[model samples]
Target: MAAPYLPMSQEEMKKLKWDQCDFIIVSGDAYVDHPSFSGAIIGRVLENEGFRIGIISQPDWRNTKDFKKLGRPYLGWLITAGNIDSMVNHYTAAKKKRSNDAYTAGGKSGRRPDRATLVYAQRCREAYKEPPIIIGGIEASLRRFAHYDYWDDKVRRSILIDAKADLLVYGMGEKTIIALAHELQERRAREEKEQSFAIDLQGLCYVTDTVATLQPQEVITLPSYEEVKESKVAYAKAFRLQEQEQNPYNGKILLQQHQDLFLVQNRPSLPLTTKELDAIYALPFARQPHPSYANQGGVPALEEVEFSLAAQRGCFGGCSFCALTFHQGRIIQSRSDESLVEEAKELVQAPSFKGYIHDVGGPTANFRQQACKKQAKAGACRHRHCLFPEPCKNLEINHDHYLQLLRKLRQIKGVKKVFIRSGLRYDYLMADKKERRRRFLEEICQHHVSGQLKVAPEHASPKVLQYMGKPSIKVYEDFKKEYEETNRKLDKKQYLVPYLMSSHPGATLHEAIEMAEKIRDWKYMPEQVQDFIPTPGSLSTCIYYTGIEPRTMEPVTVPRTPKEKALQRALLQFRKPENYELVYQALCSAERQDLIGPGSKKLISPPMSQKFKNRKLFSDKEGRGKGKGKKRRH
Candidate 1:
């Protein structure tokens, strides 16, 4: 049987024969004890180490009463914005408030405050002033230093300052948390004064007022917060340095001043070892939402990943629009095949377990291990990406290990089918010169794919793809050919669900139309198209805000106008009845009236009546540019 849920109330703690929780975890999400939730992982990890942990999920941030419900923690209070940044959770890419939060019970929104980590930490301070307030998870991790805040439209100081947090743990912080917990435990056991924080561990950062006193061997002091806030050039430079020091093996310390205090970030923690990864996964997670959520229709987020197996963590795909490199780092860390297979066995036995396993993959499914053997020692190159314009010569592009792991999963008695549902880097897969790619493709076609597979071919425009740090469209075309060939050989009718996006930084209406033309050739109507959201810490966001690429400090064309953005998005889903007006406006605005008539090259028919003449998200001058739609036969 699975272990009991961690105590959320004092009565439950009393049953555990505990006077107080050693750590009280305050999260913006409802307390779900699944590993997919950050609070659950940290709680379980702490529990495995014999720490008395309690949870206060989605507490009212209005006052300290709800924050004090769990009583004081013996070691510290763990504050997180939950599985996702609370702002992103509550708001849409268009800055409109969303009505429901998947991570919340009953799928409710407004349960947590904006900038949740800050509010939670402040509440903890009000509840009890003594113990440390440690903020983490994606929100705190990404904002450990001064970062661009899309909602506010300006750079904000490190979270530690705004939250008044004692220490900030960034990145995937399991190793750092464990080490810090042990240190805090020693002093508490001996009944000594709260010791000063010593944040030498990788994947950790803390605030300091004295920069000269710190060990300066490899410290990189960035432009001050004042500078970054006032100057775009300084902001871009700071971001570049922050992105470069993500490697654990060879990374240096980064410091950026805010007020008198400086945010000192140590190098990231090394990716967990296979043995360590196995042990963490082996922990007895109840693998379900807390029993309290049962009457409230349960946690909706659990439905997606509860039955799935996370075989690995981290990514090397290096998409500029992605934030994984900063948070999970570039090194790929996989659990042992034995560990995942064992998890599959337990997963099948769950009362809700069906015959199918949802997924057995991570950030990038095809990446099972490090991009290359040398990455562990030397770290990723400072200015280069493993896969971008093209796959690097040093990239190790074999999928044999992943194939073997999949076969092992497929052999599990209760599992009728195992699917590879995670996002994959097809370019990396195609770069494998060895015959291993063929065998792997064949295996995936015959056994792994669940009818259709999804891959991101973000755009068709070479200029936009380059700015987005994606490979050329030709790479996707070549892979599509190979995928079709494999399906033909296997006699399978599976299709590739190519994920397309619109209005990414550097995307114009021309690019959006180009992508629509490509989609038309496939004779598929996309049910949904992702609008490029400028989240914190991404190079794409930098371009969106400053109109300059952070790395190169070169000006970039950004689609910031709401009407234009909507038009670009509509272009991708031209078949939708609601989008017809927008598509027509966009084509006409671009002076491509030829694409509006009833012809082979047309995207939408001419106005059905005088009623269509008034639509105006676009005008004659809206999308005017030198380039018009170039007729091309595919």
Candidate 2:
């Protein structure tokens, strides 16, 4: 059965009768040979290309012994920091060390070093002096340009330069990795005796001393690294240009000066066609973790998605806080219904198969095809968004394809139910004027929902939503009423879980309190609270660091001081006993003492400790004397 899974050890290599590997993929995540994992996807893609590849997952980075376990590769090394950025994997939004890693075996934390891409590359070089290294995945892709490092508390150079890797594949790298493997094989053969090779490929980035080797008007030089570091305006301008140039068809070769060297990013890789996506998902992935991890509780990361199918890729919703536009681009590509149905048949045959299919969606659940017909031939507009502020007039919203796929899966012999747990873009669902949109929502509520349907109405404040590239609160409100009405007709009590974020840039104490009030109206205290963490190369990060909107260059309200950040976050969960002190101080700071008393309008009651009397800040009155919230402009 094609050896069940790719070779992860030398004994497996011996069983395959392969003398050596062409590439050794080193990753920071424990090896889960499933399509949901980038390392597994890359390994399978390279293997399909006839390159003997092996995975070195979560190796010890402080020394070279673990990396040398795979021996030397004939071609080079392909490295990644797994599906998530390393720093994010290690630290919480409050900069506290996370106690568990979902991607690791047994959910262990601190399994790998911070900045794992750079660390893994160094280990690879130490293990084999002359082996070429290429880095990708979320860490290196988003950091391909010079970006502000939140952990380091300063602007850092591109990871291509910092990692000292030869090349970086930026986005959904299925196509890029296959093409890169073939090219590297041919080029390395051609220049066998040379010191090293220079790679020039689309959808890849590298540092160069100069930009002389380019066609006129093809290479776009951005603000230098030093210039962007010194001036917020320059940084905003550079970020805007980077966003504009992500389209595969219309994008230009982007360049930026990093001291004397230039960090060059080529146009994004063309999205996989349906045939390509079909073949990719169709790869014999074992559809589970490697058997070796069975002793360590398997891979916890695969629990939710082990049986769930990835129906599509890319998002057109264009939430500013999201890095999808940079990592996966705005183009929506999906697999054929037949291919997905075939997978369901395979899914049902598994020994551990449950009657319930967890999910069948991607970046956004309802997005199955391109936003509009013209997007495929031309590209997503550089200056405009697909669904933000409002849906584009040209938007083509249809859920028939997705609904049909779901219907087919539901009819499968062994399948009792199918769920759509992946997030649904509420605005997109509301944007469709057709009846299918309503039917889609009904179908989802009736069959797909596992008790609760999840949607992101990030905040109630219009200004905060604007900064977040999300629609106004009115959209969510209208959708909620309709959803309730739909449930009323069906005589079901399905609920909606609204995903909320706190401390987002442009959301101060005032806006957070407004959101808390909205939560109060809904009578929902969210179980999962997403405190905004500014990861690299996102538009929201630009505003968070520079205090200026990247696209507009307007002054923005950014709460950077640790005290302000904590208070804003605390206001969202004002009812929590531990947040009482922080929330009390925030209400006092904002001069809205009305929200702190024991009144029906209050968010939290005062503390009952004697220390309150000892300290002058805590009072027995506790807003007994009413005070109004100060008026503020949007």
RMSD values, in order shown? 3.8, 4.6
In candidate 2, stretches whose alpha carbon ends up further than 4 angstroms from where it belongs are 195-198, 606-634
Q: Taking the tens digit of each residue's C-alpha lDDT, what string does model 1 give over 416-526?
A: 999989998889888986487788889999998888999998899998998889999888999998999999999999998989888998888898998988887777788
Clashes of each: 0, 0
Candidate 1 clashing pairs, residues 3+ apart or interchain = none
- On TM-score, the leading prediction is 1
TM for candidate 2 is 0.94
The local distance difference test score of each candidate is 0.85, 0.85
Model 1, TM vs. native: 0.95
